[model samples]
Target: MTSTSARPRLAAGQTTDKDIASFLAHTEPVDALAQDGYLAGHDGRAIAQQLRRPGLVRALTFSVCHSARPDTDRFYQDDEEEAAQWRRRRTQTIRDHCAVCPVRAACAELALRDEDVHGVRGGLPEEKLALRLATDADRLGKARAADDRVERLRSVRLDAEREVHRVALMHTGGSVPAAKRAENNDEVRTAVQERDAAKKAHRTENGWTVAA
Candidate 1:
């Protein structure tokens, strides 16, 4: 069982002076930015300096502090079942903090744009954010990478089907003998089965709706 007490706690109200001070004292701003994949090609010291500005600090999602569970990194790296337990414990803490947070929308938007970012943000987990990212790609004006992946898989399946057909034809005798035809049919059946399985797997991975 997961212990909810391990989650971060936040006091009610606006971004207080105490909140800002506690966040800076307990958390490393640059590390949080780096985890969001926003630190590349940027100097850590410079980012940290910018984060110290009161306005920027107040606007930051992590500035709420309590939304950031200390075990976030560990949570993402653990086995699925263990990670799920951690997520359940952390869920209410995130919800409580985000309910009054000033930057919840911005935080959710950022989470949507970054696929590699893990852990909870704006009351949503990384997995939920990933699904939103995929489903909302067109709405967000991003390229549909999932569509591209499906196209690639379709191509692969077609190639496999073609190869099976080629093998069947290659084994056909001059008179199209029964034994040869039987062998060809078996090979073709196996190939079609393999192709269907691959297509099903691709659809599942990309969350494509299965056709009737």
Candidate 2:
């Protein structure tokens, strides 16, 4: 806050005085993020104020910047434990304030757009928001990464299987046919089998009887 005070404040715009002065006088490239499909949705103007106010949003972002995973769980994890209990109590206050707020989407858009912003954006703040963001971002990242890896590995496995099928077709009149070989190379079938194998192993290792 003290650090940010020197940054340029928003000039009164053509709209009402109540509208938030921009958080950044000029929206820097670093400050802008992929908000097209990212924000969870909320009122823009009202939410923007919460973002502009420096306390909870700033505290949570700072915590995430220092965190190992750059995620919201850092808020609850308590490295900011100097005032951990106080911080948790403070979260409720932020929530109460946000509850009265009419601009939750604006807050969410600001958070999503600014990579620097983390944790809960609107009605929630700090660890409450952080935990959800971490879960969502982690799940999305993991799934996308897994999909890429699966695609690459699928090509490798399919090429190998094709070679075997080709060799069989050449050696035996009908040992392995082109149709079965073609079906095995499919993305859905291979991915499903791969997922199943991984799940089975995970379940066994975790001592679970059901497949994940």
lDDT: which candidate is best? 1
- TM-score for each candidate, following the candidate numbering: 0.32, 0.24
Write the residue-wise lDDT of candidate 1 on 90-158 in tens digits.
Answer: 675665565455444445554554444477665567777788777777644432344355557777778
Q: What is the C-alpha local distance difference test score of candidate 2?
A: 0.42
Best by TM-score: 1
> What local lDDT does model 2 show for residue 200?
51
Give stretches of model 1 more than 4 Å off: 1-58, 61-63, 66-84, 142-212
Q: Positional deviation of 128 in candidate 2, in angstroms?
A: 3.5
Candidate 1 lDDT for residue 109: 51
Global fold similarity of model 1 (TM-score): 0.32
lDDT of each: 0.51, 0.42
Question: Over the stretch 1-212, how does candidate 2's per-residue lDDT look in tens digits?
Answer: 12344444456563543333223211311123112211123334333332322222432332223232333343343555667675775566555444444334445434543433454555555555455456557543543454355445545556655655554444334565777666655644556565556555433332222211
Clash pairs of candidate 2? 41-105, 42-105, 43-105, 47-103, 72-130, 119-129, 119-130, 120-129
